[model samples]
Target: MVLSQNEFLPRAESTLARLEGAVLDALSHHGKPSVSSLAGVFRQEARLSPSQLAQALCPGPLSPIGFAALVMRELLAPVDVVLEGSVSEARVVTGNARAPSSLRVTCPLIVLGDLEVEGVLEDCGPDSTVVVLGRCTAWGLQTSGNFLVLGDLVVRDVIQGVYNDESLVVAGDLTTRFLDENDHDVTCYGEVHAEHHLENGRSGDAAVTLASTFLRPELWNVDLGELHHDALFERIQEGEPVFTDAPQAPQVREPDAPTAEELEGLDIEGIAAQASTNARAKDVVYAQRKTGEVWLMRPGSLPLHIFDGKQLLGQGTPPALDVKQRASERVTFWRKRGDLFLEIERFGAVVQLHAGQNNGSLRTFRFAFATPDDAAQEVRRLEARYTGDFLRVTSMIPGRGPLERELANYGGPKTEYTSAIVDGTTLVTRDGERQRFDDEASALSALEDWLAGKRQAGFDLKILEWKPYGLLG
Candidate 1:
């Protein structure tokens, strides 16, 4: 009757326990037991091959009790052992079977038909033949011969002959004198070194001339006839000239703004003064001659008063000067039929007042000023009044004069891209165009279409996350 792995496990355990006791008794009676003798007895009694038994009792120094424990562990270790020439039909082996304690096939473990071992195979003798019609793994395989793995083969240590079909993965270095015939494709995660040459299967001619070709082809691709050790050393010591296809030019970068000391030598203030004269101070419409104060006039009787640098200094009536005589004298004041006009030519300041209107009424007064030191001070005061901080001005309505230009030097509002979460359902594109969706299905469909379009255009799309929210009634 065929027994399942579950039923066979208990019998295997009981048999190993009995074998351990018998091996221990033999060791005690023989003083220093010979490995070959003990191995021979175990093979006869347990039906294990010499290679399998030898591997179980590894070459090392250990007490008789310790040795027995090691032997028992190796025997009871989880593995699918097909006794000598027992596998006549196809068999599939699975699960992780690792290293010295795992699998042990007695004779040449031949797979005549098809066989699949998913886990591992280790420590097979040189004479043993493992022929798998399907895929298999050899975690620590040690063998050489008519070995054919039809599917993917992951192996380490000596392997010869055709690896047949599918890919062959080498875990460690693949060291061989030559690859006589390798029909299947191979990808080694580690290095591949050959003492001789690597040849193609068809011509059997050398494919690689030197082993260093696997490392650096440019340095090692010299003709063998032209290569001389002494000459090569002399040339290297003399620093051989390297030739290139094109000479690379050094990159030029824009110089950083000059330091304060370097700027001090420049007439930056003079240039600014000239530029300011051409740019009018739109916000500064009125100035007090005595206090050097400025005001923002906005179609009102009492102007929004400001002091040096556009700072809010409060409001007041025009200076009490003799308007009629000053108008006649043309000394900054003019009067016509109860109306008043004043102009401070030094600061380019202008102000006008109409009679019979409330002092704060919007239609009662008109005021303006041109760009000058006093006028610039007034502009700064106005900026301070508008933005709270003297440095920032949101709109260009006030004219980007010297004050605004200074603010520009300090920079402006910073914008950065960040992943935005959608409380409901929404779709957003790379260009910032957004569409709102009432349901998740529609949003997902639109997102899929957008991803497909992006993929066709050679874009790699990554969906960060999708979170669903439910509404409670």
Candidate 2:
């Protein structure tokens, strides 16, 4: 009996082992053993074969036979697979927890009601790992509750539910029907490029500057032209007002004009009368004989000018207008009608006249002279012969128009090479240096005193030649 019992113990132990496994399987409705959960159930209920030593242990079935394999195989087959987990195929990862199959994976499919993360991630740098979205068999990767991925994320077509956890970043390209009816909702924090269609009622937006517009790197393999400035502005934005510099109008008159008194030698003077009630005591106004262009005098103002009815013409300051005269000379003043007026010398002795009607006068005089050292000797002798006993005085009435004031002052102290009106002649210096002045009268006095000293120094004096200024009466 004892020998029989020993032999039967091996067979009974085998049968009981099978029975306990069957019970665990039956509790699961004979579903496949899962690496995820079935192992725990088997460990708790599993026992050693009858009469086997307590130290001896039994290894359970290797892995869960997925529904397909279980249905296909008549008997249960263990399918334990060793695997390495990672974000990408590029690197190795740590974590004992794993999926049953990476390739032919199986898990629950949750169709998305809206686009959102599955609440499983954190913010990270530009190129870090996010989430790996893919198509798996029914019920494959079902976390009991929520999942968060600290890296980036990706979404594939078969992911049916809203992935509400991680923000997405794509090293390559991305596409989706996130807004299409009956399609899943996918919320992403990144930009969308490449060709794609979105689902119904979905909206997408991005923050970008006008300058952010740029060309795509490659259309497959062809190169694109560099974006033009105008097109670049147009591409990324609209409704921003386009702006450029405005065009300016051209001025009517040149800033420079030749003077009649300068050219025609018309230095005659008379007290002018006002023709316009608008004229004041010192208003200066001149009219051209042919064109009737009236040049008005506004002293100390810019744009010294003559005005026609339609346009004002600039007459830049004329050379000093003041010249000395004992008798009548050309004069400027207000007319009775309030208009400013000007006229050449009236009722004067007519010492001489140049052929041209506009040329006020042609005057010449002769003088005796003996040699003197150099520069200005002949001019000094000539001037003494013409007006040795008489003074030629010109006074400029102050607070007058700029046209006459700027152009008319004369006889300033000049530098060594400059010209000075000594006596009545423009004594030009040899080297053409500029001159300075203490006062106009002082400058004139110095030159005059120097000439007198020259004569007293026993330098020979005699008849000298003289001529009137271009402007004369």
Highest TM-score model number: 1
Off by over 4 Å in 2: 1-159, 162-185, 200-473
lDDT for 135 in candidate 1 is 36
Query: What digit string (tens of lDDT, one per residue) describes model 2 on residues 1-473?
Result: 01123333344334334433322332233233333332232353343221121111111111121111121122222222233222222111111122322321112111111112221212122222222222111111112112222112233211222233322222122343111111232333334332223332332211011111222211011111111223322321332322212322321221122345422422112111222344332433444333333443443332123343334322233222112222122222222121222222211232111010011221122222232222134433323432411122322211111111101112335311112232222322222322445565554445444334433433211211121231111
Model 1 alpha-carbon miss at residue 154, Å: 2.9
Off by more than 4 A, model 1 = 1-97, 100-107, 110-126, 138-144, 156-211, 215-473
As a whole number from 0 to 100, the lDDT of residue 427 in candidate 2 is: 28
- TM values, all candidates: 0.18, 0.13
Model 1 clash tally, residue pairs: 7
lDDT of each: 0.32, 0.24
